[model samples]
Target: MRVHSLFLYPVKSLAGVEVSVIDLDDFGPVGDRRWMLVNDQGEFVTQRKLPALARIGTGIDERGVSVHIPGEGRFHLAPGHEELSVLVWRDWMNSLIGPKQASAAVSRFCERSLRFVYMPDDTFRRVDPARVVDQKRVGFADGFPFLFANQASLDELNSRLKHPVNMRHFRPNIVISGAEPWSEDHWQYLTIGQARFKAVKPCSRCVITTMDPDTGTKDPGTEPLRTLSTYRKTQDGVIFGQNAVHQDGDHLSVGDAVIICPQES
Candidate 1:
């Protein structure tokens, strides 16, 4: 099988940026989920609560991120912002607070008091101890560094749904084509391009999947999740894709061949 696409969400919970090639570091993909939106209490805000975040656009360059909201103006987060402690999930993480103007602009769009923060190099946001095999760390992502989805699997889910949902609803970092439906469920190890990875766990489905990536509008029916639960329900939750961690190497590109190894018998 070959990699069909690569995506990076520089800021967690926003629409991701598709790229032809990605340079992986200790943090999986460079600039992936390194920034996040937080509320006054420093609690992380996401599309799960504020679907409007989906409309926020981010462009990353060597300097930093350029953020834009339609008809609302733009803001930027460059180096040398103030440091602040923000709460993500259960962890309190140290992050660089975006400028007040930028924060206010986003706050207006979100219709809440929000601040944008950037993950710094010194911070080590450890992955969940129970599921992680190695001493892996993530940025603002929910758990692992990478999330993988198979096209065939999505095809199967789409066949089940009355209105097919696109891949964007799932927000996988790596999209693999040419794999059998749900084949990733049996994969223990994989090598994509020069990078190696361990399939750590299955990603659970959530309400965020029901939100339209472009408009930030939610599907009243709570589809994909509602349908998946009937068949894909596990003790963990309704599941879809696999969460993974980078074992070694750097670059991954679209069309790179994928070599998989099933779990040992």
Candidate 2:
């Protein structure tokens, strides 16, 4: 198997950019989900409540990051010196608040009050201790440094759906091809290019998967999820992809061979 695609989400919950090559830092992919949106309560907001977020595009350059929302025009966010505490899941993380202009743009796009924030070098949010013992840290991602998905698993899910959802629905960081459907479930460790990653947990499916990443519209029947409930249902939720943590090495590129490390008997 080989790396089929690479993705980077400069801001959390926005449309992701597919890249040919990416550097894997201790925080997962460089510039991946380092920025995010939050409400007045300081809690993070995502596509789960606002599907329109899927239409918001993000790009980063030497200056800083830019957010583009149709009609609302483009707004740029530079790293600020001010730090604010924001909530993601149950953790309260310190983040560099984006400039007022960027916050206003995001609020208008979401049609609600919101603030833009970025994780700085000082803010080290540890991975849930129960999930992995490595004490690794992630950016604004849900819980892990990386998310890996097999194309064959999506192929199998598409075979069961009427509309046939694509890989974008899951928004994984690393995508692999040429593996049996759901074969990642058995993988304990994998090597892609020079990077070694340990599969930490099976990513749980949610309503976000039912929404169209391109159009920001959701399926009325909540497809994929509805169908997944029948078979992919677990005690926690419906499982789709695998969450991984970087263990060693660096850099990933498309077409790099993926070697599944053998498990000890």
Candidate 3:
């Protein structure tokens, strides 16, 4: 199989930036999910709470990361040094409260009070040790460093649904082509381009997937999720993709070869 596409989410929950190349730093993908939106209570919020977040697009350039509000305007995201304790899922860690203008501008669009937070390199959030033995770190992403999905797997799902959905629905970091449907389930280790990764676990499907990545609205029929639940449901929840940790690699490019290697049992 080969890499079909790649995506980088400069800010968590915001529309991701599709790039042909990704540089891996200490984190899985450079410039991915370093920024996030938090509620007034110092808790992180996402499309699950306010689907309009999906409408907020993200972009990264020499100037840094910027958020784009459709039909409104774009603003540069600048997080300051003021540290704030925020909760992402069950893990609470330190974060930076960015500029007030960013909070106000986005609040006006989402119509709710929110704060922009940045996870600096100093703020370390450990991945679930039960799934990954190594104490790997994660940013604002849900729980893992990288998420991989097979294109054939998506095609298999689309065939069962009334309306087809794109890869954005599941928000995978790496999309593999030429793989059999559901082949990722058996992938214990992978070498994509220069990077090596270990499949931590199957990513659970959620309501966020039911929300359209563009319009920030739910599917009237609750399709993909509705269809997925019927057959893909598992003890972990409805499964769609695999969450992986960066084992080794400096960079990843589109069309890179995906090698499934035997695990070191």
The root-mean-square deviation over C-alpha atoms between each candidate and the true structure, in angstroms, is 1.6, 1.5, 1.2
Which stretches of model 2 miss by more than 4 angstroms? none
Question: Candidate 1 versus the native: TM-score?
Answer: 0.96
All candidates' lDDT scores?
0.88, 0.89, 0.90
Model 2 alpha-carbon miss at residue 140, Å: 1.0
Model 1 lDDT-worst window of ten? 72-81
lDDT of 3 by residue, 212-250 (tens): 999989998887899999999999999999999988889
Shift in Å, residue 133, candidate 1:
3.5
TM-scores of the models, in the given order?
0.96, 0.96, 0.97
For residue 29, what is the lDDT in candidate 3?
91
What shift in Å separates residue 98 of candidate 3 from its native position after superposition? Answer: 1.2
Please, what are the lDDT tens digits per residue for candidate 2 over residues 164-223? 989999999999999999898888889888788888899998889999998889999998
lDDT of 1: 0.88
Give Cα distance to truth, residue 92, candidate 1, Å: 1.0
- Which candidate leads the pack in TM-score? 3
Go through the candidates in order and give the clash count of each: 0, 0, 0
lDDT accuracy of residue 182 in candidate 3: 94
| True-vs-predicted CA distance for residue 106, candidate 2, Å | 1.5
The top-ranked prediction according to lDDT is 3
